[model samples]
Target: MTIKLMQGNEAIGMGAIAAGCRFYAGYPITPSTEVAEILSRELPKLGGKFIQMEDEIASMAAIIGARVGGLKSMTATSGPGFSLMQENLGYAAMAEIPCVIVNVQRLGPSTGQPTAASQGDVMQARWGTHGDHPMIALTPVTVRQSFDLTVKAFNLSEKFRTPVILLTDEIIGHMREPVKLPAFETIHPYEQVVADTPESYKAFRNEPGDVPPMAPFGRGYRYHITGLFHDEVGFPTQRLDEIDPWLERVNHKFDRHLDEIIMVESDFQEGAKTAIVTYGATARSARHALKIARQRGLKVSMLTLLTIWPFPETQVESLGDQVDRIIVPEMNLGQLALEVERMVGRRKVKRVNRANGEMVTPQMILDAIEG
Candidate 1:
């Protein structure tokens, strides 16, 4: 294994290739276009497929189609493109289709700044789709993490039989850093849950794991899949009993597996009076602030979150019980801070947010730490 300098966007494309992703369909959008460009060049060399879709909606639909064809598939886009893909994303969710979506978030609220960074899509990644469906979002702070979390996103999607969102901002996507390419043995690829034989297979048949084994259409297991509520046999069912449990299982798979799914790195929290909670690129800034504050004899700990969704309630609750103050600095305007406030009770949480498409500096965090 050799370490080489790579952009975060290129790292995601390479990581997907290492994780056995064979298909990529996406339209170019600023800050995320590198992912599409790199994949288009690399996937063909590895005997894979890449298509420049007509639009984001078609791009999303095409990935879902590729997944059903038994290929590991993904799509990449920015804010406006992601918004266009939401309806189809909900389609993948309701149908329990496993796929990955890489959203390199740029300045938003209707395409404010295409080349600048923003974390405003944090809430959108959770609730972008029209309906109530579970989501898994992984935030990568470094180029290496951009590679690692892309693989994790695929694993989580296949294991849970749901769509997974890999959320990164423009700074992380564009910034270059050293990434060590893992050996083939180090790459843990997921086995697609394909059906065995031609007959005697059910796409929605529940096993002990609650997720049924999937079969592609050409593999001779012909089953219906639609956005409508489906029975165990994969056919539409109008009954509430069928729909309720389907939705419940969609959510339960993540909740029940939080121990493996939720990830956080905490430093010196045993007797700290203040805790700095952050994720994505801001987590890097927080680390610097924490170091400077400790030099000044301040008792401050830090929590760097790698997993953004499923909220990591238990971890945050435990950290909250011991700390008197929690500072959350993000690139968004109080998106994740709202969640921290809700989890840690009221004013115990303080928000340090900047949504002006610029990185929140270490000084901003130090100000919050001193305040």
Candidate 2:
């Protein structure tokens, strides 16, 4: 391993290549354009392909098309662009296409701040697409984790046959740090295995294992692909019996293997009565406050969420039982805090939110801890 000074966006580009991503489709947007820039330069050198699409909508479409052709694909964008991709993002979920989406968040409700950092898209990442489909989102607190989680995002996407979102922020995306990346050769991404012959292959089979292996477009296993409710053979069907099975299988796949899907880092002191729950760039500030609180003889624990979606309910609920109160500091107007409040209780949760594109300072978290 070699330690090199790398920015978080650069790390994500490298991670995509390492994760066997051979195709990238994206439009240029601030805070996330570097991800496309680096991929454009590097993908071709490795015999991969990268394209600058007309817009976020086309970018999302291009990547989905590429993935259907059996290439591991990805796209990156900020809030405005992410908003444009939601329609196709939902399609990927319904069709069970494996792809990664890197959202390097900036302030937004309509391009609020292009250069500033914010975690304001937390809720949007979960519910941006108008549908009831399962979603997986991962956040990174450091430059290194950005690379690692980008790789994880691709792995999870392929393994689960779902679109995985790397929900980063402008802070982590632009921040430079010494990152020791593993050798590319040492990395092996997950590849779906098709056990059935082409004559009997069912693209959306609901079998013992709900995840059906995907066969690429030209693999002799031709099956229908659609955004509507699809039967096991991939044909669109309006029948309730067909639609219900697809819904149950698609959603239950995550439920059956949540232990492997949920990722978190818990640091709890023996007698800690207060815990800080955080993710993304704000986790840095939460960690700093935890350290100082301990140094000042305060009992404080911390839970850093690496996995954002399917929310780590069991772990957070257990933490609530141990701690008197949980402090959630995010760069949004209490989006994640609402989920925490639901898992624990509104009365047991304290929220420190910022929507003005500023980092939540460690002192602000420390004050919440002391108060």
Candidate 3:
């Protein structure tokens, strides 16, 4: 393992290259621009390709096209750029294309703050893309986890045949820390195999609760790709028979593989009455609060979410059952708290929110707990 001090954005780039991501297409946006800048310089040296597209929408489209052309592909953007990419993001979901998207979030409604850290995009990452599509979004609390989760995002995207989002904020994006990474060549990416011949091909195979193998565009396999509901051969279809099974299979795969897609780190204490749940950089503050609370003779636990969507319902539900109350501190205005309330009920959830381009402080979270 080679150890180096690296920023979160740089680690994401290095992680992508290690995961066999050979093609990258993205527009430059603050906080996330470093990810693209690093790939531009590093990818060409590895015989991979990198191009700055016209804009976020084009960048999103280009990565999908590149992925269809048989390369592991990805893109990175900030809040505004991520919003622009939503249409294509939805397309990736409906078409079942495999690609990774990194959103280094900043304060936002529309370009609120370019350099400030905020996890306001948490809800957006899950539901920004239109329609009821399955999503896998992972949040990393440290620069090292940023590197680790970036690779995991690619692996999940390929395994599930969907777009996976590496959702980090500007704080984690710009923060630097020592990261020891495996040799890039030594990291084996997940691989998929297609049908033996064109004669035996079906673009969307009816695999029960599994993703169908995707054949490269020029690999002697020919099929249509569309956002519209499609059959096994990929032809546009409005037929209930074709649409229903695809819907069931795509949505249920994550539930079946929850252990793989959902990752969380928790510090639970027996007889604790409260649990502080957090993700992204706010988890740092939540930890501090936990320490103070413990020293002050309060029994408290903490749950740091590394995977946000699919929302870790089962675990949160368990926390709700075991604890007296759940406190959620987010850089957003309680976006994740809304989901927690749904799972655990509003009565069991308390929200500590900050969206003013500032990190939630330990005092703020501690106050919520003390109350």
Candidate 4:
């Protein structure tokens, strides 16, 4: 491995290539445009394809089509663009098409800020897609993790036959740092093709397992692809017998494979009275505050989330039970804090929030810990 100074967005773009992503389709949007820009320049050099779609909606649609064509596919967008892609994002989930969506979040209700940093999209990444579906959302704290997790996003998407969201923000996307990336040939992305003959293969079969391998569209593995609830053969179905089985399998798949889906890092004192729980860019400040609290002889711990969706509920609950108070720092008006409160009860949680275009400094978190 070689070390190089690279921006996080660039690292994500490079990581996708290393992860065997052969197709990228995106429309430029602030804070995240760099990912698309880098991939546009790099994909062609590596015998891959990159397309600039007319809009974010088309970009999302194109990647799914590309993935169905047997090429690992991805797209990158920010705030408004992400909103435009939601319908298609949900379609990818319903159709069980494995693709990666890199969302470099900016502050937004509706195009609120273009270059600003925010973690406001936390709920949107999980519930924005309109249906009851299991989603995997990974957030990276640094440039290196950005690269590492982008590859992980692709792997998880392929492994579970679902769309995976790489939830990032302006801070991590634009931050510059040195990272050691693995060789492309040495990296592995979960393959999603069936070995059996087409006649015997059922595209959406749930008989033997929750996930059935996806056969590439052009490899004589022709099957219907739609957002509607479908039968094992890929035809839209209304029968409760067919629908219930698909629902059970898709929803329980993540639960059965929690070991691989939930990822977190803990830095806790043996007997800490306070804890900082955070993810995405806010973890940077949380880490600094954790160090300061320890230096001041205060017992403290921190839980940094790498996977944001599927919520790591048990871990957070256990952490809440161990500490007298749980501090959550975010760049929004307490979006994730609402989830934490539900898990641990309102009495044990403290929130530090920032809605303006600025990073939450360590002092803000330190103050919360002391309070």
Candidate 5:
């Protein structure tokens, strides 16, 4: 393993490369531009292709095309750019294209704050697309985890045949830390293929894993992919049967594999009366508060969610039943807190929020624990 000091954006580029990503298409956006910059410089040297699209929508569309062309593809962006990519992002999902989307989140409702850290996009990343679709999103706290999780994100996307979001913030994207890089041979990439014959191809047919292996165009798999609801053959259909199966399969891919697909970290969760819950950067502060509370002889633990979606409802509800109170600290105004309350029921979940382009510190969480 090679230990190198790297920024999170650089780490994502390197991680994608390590994951055998050969196609990158993205328009530059702040706090995330470095990912596009580094990938543009490196991909060509490694016999890969990089395209700087005219805009985020076209960039997303182009990457989907590359994926259909039998290449592992990805795109990166911040708020405004991400907003533009939403339509095609929904397209990728509807067609069940496997790719990674890195959203290095900035404060936003509409370019709310650029070059600042915010987790406000947490809900958007999960539900930003128009309809009901299952999405796999991974949140990384440290720069090293950013590298590791990006690779995992790609793997999950490919394995599930859906677009996976690497939900990160400007803090982690710009943070510098030492990451231990595994050997290229040690890293395994997701599989892809091009159909040898055009006759025997069905783009949306579900295999045992609820994902159909893709064969890129020009390799003889002359198929059409569209954003509209489609049948198993990837052709648009208004039939309820087609729509039902299509939506069911999409949800099945994640639901059947939830235990395998979702990752969560629970610290001192057993028999705790007071618990602090968090994810992303805010979890760091929650961890610190947990440590201090333990030192002061308080029965406080933390459940830091590594997998934000699929909600981890089973685990959260169990923790809630054991704990007298659960305090959720996030960078937004009770976004995750709402989910926690929904899962565990009201009257037990409290929230500590901050939304002014600032980090939630340990004292903030400690006060919640003490309260």
Candidate 6:
């Protein structure tokens, strides 16, 4: 292991390489451009490929195609760029292509602030892509966790045969801190193994396990790939029998194994009546408030969400039972608070939100806790 001062965006680039990503294709966007910059310089050193696509749409398409051709692939973009990739992002989900997308979020309705930080993309990461599909999104509070979760994002994407989003904000994306990264060779990424012969391989087989092994396009296993609802053999099918099974498998795959997908950090005080629940960069502020609250004899706990999508409903629900009140701090105007409110209740959930490209500070949360 090597200890080094690393920025969060830099950590993501290093993590992608460590995760066995051999292909990166993206157009530059603020707070996220560093990921592409680092990868462009590093990928070629390891015999990997990096391409500067004309736009985010092509960038998303390129990575999917690279992954289809047997290389682990990824792309990075901000909000507007992320918007452009949504259609293709949906395609990757529908086609069951495993790829990682890094969205280093900026304040945005449409390029609202290029260099400003915001967690406004929380909902977009889950529902940005159209149609019903399983999505995995991981957020990190520290530089080290940024690297760690980027690797986790790739692993989950490959393991579940779905697109995984590394949802970050300008704060974590640009912030620098000391991180200890393991040797590249020591970091083992999950590889999808194809056990069946080409003739026996069914790309979208709805079998006992929801996740079927994927065979790359150029491999002897030449199977169809499309965005349409398809049969086990990957052919576009209109039959309810075929479509229903695919939908059931794809949608419920994450649900069936949610124990493995959902990750959270719980710092609980035995008699705590109030809890601070947050994710991404806001988690840093939440943690600080938690520390100060505890020091001042305010019995408060904190739940930091790492996996944002799939919501971690079970954990939040249980937290609701234990705590009298839940304070949710976010850079957005209470985006994630809605889910927390759903699990807990609006009455029990206190929201501290800011969407002006400014972070919800620890004092804001401390005030909420005291109030």
TM-score of each: 0.97, 0.99, 0.98, 0.98, 0.95, 0.98
| Clashing residue pairs in candidate 4 (N, C-alpha, C atoms within 3 angstroms) | none
lDDT of residue 206 for candidate 5: 53
Model 2 lDDT per residue over 254-325, tens place: 998889889999999999899999999999999999899999999999999999897999999999999999
Please report the TM-score between candidate 1 and the true structure: 0.97
Q: How many residue pairs clash in each candidate?
A: 0, 0, 0, 0, 1, 0
lDDT of 6 at 305: 97
lDDT of 3 by residue, 1-371 (tens): 77788999999998998898999999999989999999999999989999989999999999999999999999999999999999999999989899999999999889898988899988888899888899999999999899889999999999889999999999999999888987777777888877458988887876779788888899789999998889998999899988899888877878778999899998999999999989999999999999999999999989899999889998888988889899999988889999999989999999998989999999999998899
Tell me how far the alpha carbon of residue 340 in candidate 4 is from the true structure, in angstroms, after superposition: 1.5
lDDT of each: 0.87, 0.93, 0.92, 0.90, 0.85, 0.93
Report the CA-based lDDT of candidate 5 relative to the real structure. 0.85
lDDT of 4 by residue, 1-371 (tens): 78998998999998898888999999998989899888889889989999999999999999999998889999999989889999999999889999999999998878888989999899999899798988899999999899889989999999999999999999999999888887877888777758779888888887634688899887887689889999988899999999999998888778878879889999878988889899988999999888888899889999999998888899999998899999999999998888899899999999999989789999999998887
How does residue 116 of candidate 4 score in lDDT?
91
Sort by lDDT, best first.
2, 6, 3, 4, 1, 5
Q: Per-residue lDDT tens digits of candidate 5, residues 247-315? A: 677776777788867788888745679888788888888888888888998888788787787688888
lDDT for 239 in candidate 2 is: 92
Clashing residue pairs in candidate 3 are none
Better of 3 and 6 by lDDT: 6
Expressed as tens digits, the lDDT of each residue in 239-305 for candidate 1 is 9987777766766666668887898888864578899989998898899998898899888989888
Write model 6 residue lDDT over 1-371, tens digit each, in one string. Answer: 77889999999999999999999999999989999999999999999999999999999999999999999999999999999999999999999999999999999889899999999999999999888888999999999998889999999999999999999999999999989998878888999988899999998999645699899887688788888888898889999999888888888888778888899999888999999898999998888888888899889989999999989999999999999999999999888999999999899999999999998899999999999
Model 6: how far residue 8 lies from native, Å: 0.3
Worst lDDT 10-window in candidate 2: 205-214
